[model samples]
Target: MKTLPILLSCWLLLSSCGNNSQPAADTAATTTPDKPAPAKAASKPTILFFGNSITAGLGVDPEQAFPALVGQKIDSAGLGYMVVNAGLSGETTAGGRSRVGWVLRKPVAVFVLELGGNDGLRGLPLTDTRRNLQAIIDTVRQLSPQAKIVLAGMQIPPNLGADYAAQFKQLYGELAQKNKLTLIPFLLEGVGGVAKFNQRDGIHPTPEGHRLVARTVWAVLQPLLRQPMAQAQ
Candidate 1:
């Protein structure tokens, strides 16, 4: 009778231990840790530079172009924007209008338009040039409604006659006023008449000249970039 009681006590002790372990195992199985929250998608804003040979950096290294230089400034300043240099040599306002839709395939936070110089050089009718520029703007607005626009004003040599030159320069202001956009009056400001800044052809700017142009663009562009990336739209 004594041995039976001891065996019963031992059995009860083991059963109690097993019952305690079972609850712990059950709790572990039933109560899993909560899943971590999903990560947010990265949103990098794109600054698209749309223009002609000046933007293309003709007669100079493409990297030395004002647009690319602007990109360098953006990187240096930690602005964290993607700069798309969509400049094409020999592109006129009409040409830009035709290709703008294709270029704006992706989202754009800022749109820098630098065209109409070729139109002026070729003596194309100002009305046609204006219409083409307006069309390009319309296309940009349609595709990227939230994008900020910067109009690059251009000037032609006095050979086109003072009246024509005056009208050409005035057109950019008119466009900016009408569209309520930012304007960079005279893209080739200091480099235009300066012999050292321009190439042998007396047209396209040299690499050093491009630096000045980049500075000019950066002046207006830096302010826009100061806004948070989420607020760029």
Candidate 2:
């Protein structure tokens, strides 16, 4: 009984120790640092127009070239795409084949391939043309599987032997079929052989003829551009 006070003091001390030693639950709100809003995806699809002088806007005034006209159409139609012309004057499939590797480095959405005209003009071998064009398609596919390809077919001048001309014209169709690609049969269409449509040389097109070419290109391209997978991300 006399030690009762001592026991009570020990009990109090233990109670105080327990209170001090017990861990309190943390109630602080933990939140992820407010992340910056994700960047908006680019609205404009990028189309790489890879070809020869036709794409380069060569021989025509800058504004009157086929690529420029195509750009205007894209803008007017509100397709939300930009066209990049990598065309060079007097370029052949062999040259294009050599250059295409470097060309693939760009962020290309789709390729508007208008090669083979110079090849035919220079009387290059059919095998060389086929190899070069096929290589282009293959390279594009390898680099960008989602890329849509539109091959603009060019006919050999009839002055070339009939057999060779036939083979050259047939090549475009065959490539289109084999690769499941889109074809703009006879890129010049209404303008190729016409006097009013061509330049004085009768080989290249005049400004009016380029406009028609752009219109023809647009007719085929607009449909593909409308397709969902055809646009770049």
Candidate 3:
């Protein structure tokens, strides 16, 4: 796939990058009832997109983020689901493990776990990344037994070693099979490694890139939503 070259470039840039500041949560729908709105809107089910910079829509308008685009598709289809962008920039699986509970304070019908990309990018221990991700999955299962979990798979260049890169790419499938979760094989399918789709950083997707991402995610998510929650478990 074109993922290797793109991610190799990303690794080079990220190696020299040191900032890890996190921004506020970006939600596609209003979670609070404080605003003036119809009761029906307030009671919609939530689809939480939790991940790092890509999920945060870095370098693009918030509305152009893939999660927001998914939210729009959900609305257009009258799916009656709210999309919550709980993505935090520069977050690793360890960080996600530490904060997932807080982000799950509200009820969520569909929980899309998009983390671990940073862990892979940094070439951290695959075991630790696996453990942290498992912890996050367990937490969601414990807290929301009926919620359907969706795993967003990510890949990295072999700069860290071919074996490591292969294992990292395989991690998501392993988790999904073990947990009976829905899987988005590759979150950046058509967008990754494409110059026009990526920003100058060669990492985060452009607005148009997010559009393709939204479609990739929606393809997996839409079918999952149609299935019975019990079946998804």
In model 1, the clashing pairs are none
Per-residue CA lDDT of model 3 for 1-233, tens digit only, reads 00100111222232233244221122113322353222333355667788999998888877888988887787777676656677889999999999988776655688999999889989899999999999999999888777899999998878899999999999999999999888999999988889999999888999899999999999999888767655443
Quote the RMSD, in angstroms, for model 1.
22.4
Question: What's each prediction's TM-score?
Answer: 0.80, 0.79, 0.83
What's the candidate order when arranged by decreasing TM-score? 3, 1, 2
Q: What does candidate 2 score on TM?
A: 0.79
Residue range 1-233, candidate 1, lDDT tens digits: 00000111222232345433332221211122342110000134667888898988899866778887887788778776656678889999989999998777665789999999999999999999999999999998999998999999999987878899899999999999999988999888899889999999888999999989989999988998898766676
Q: Worst 10-residue stretch by lDDT in candidate 2?
A: 1-10
Model 1 weakest 10-residue run by lDDT: 1-10
lDDT of each: 0.76, 0.72, 0.77
Q: Name the candidate that leads on lDDT.
A: 3
Q: Global CA lDDT of candidate 2, please?
A: 0.72
Q: What are the per-residue Cα lDDT tens digits for candidate 2 across 161-227?
A: 9999999999999999999999999898998889998888887888899989989999988888777
Off by over 4 Å in 2: 1-43, 229-233
What local lDDT does model 1 show for residue 227? 80
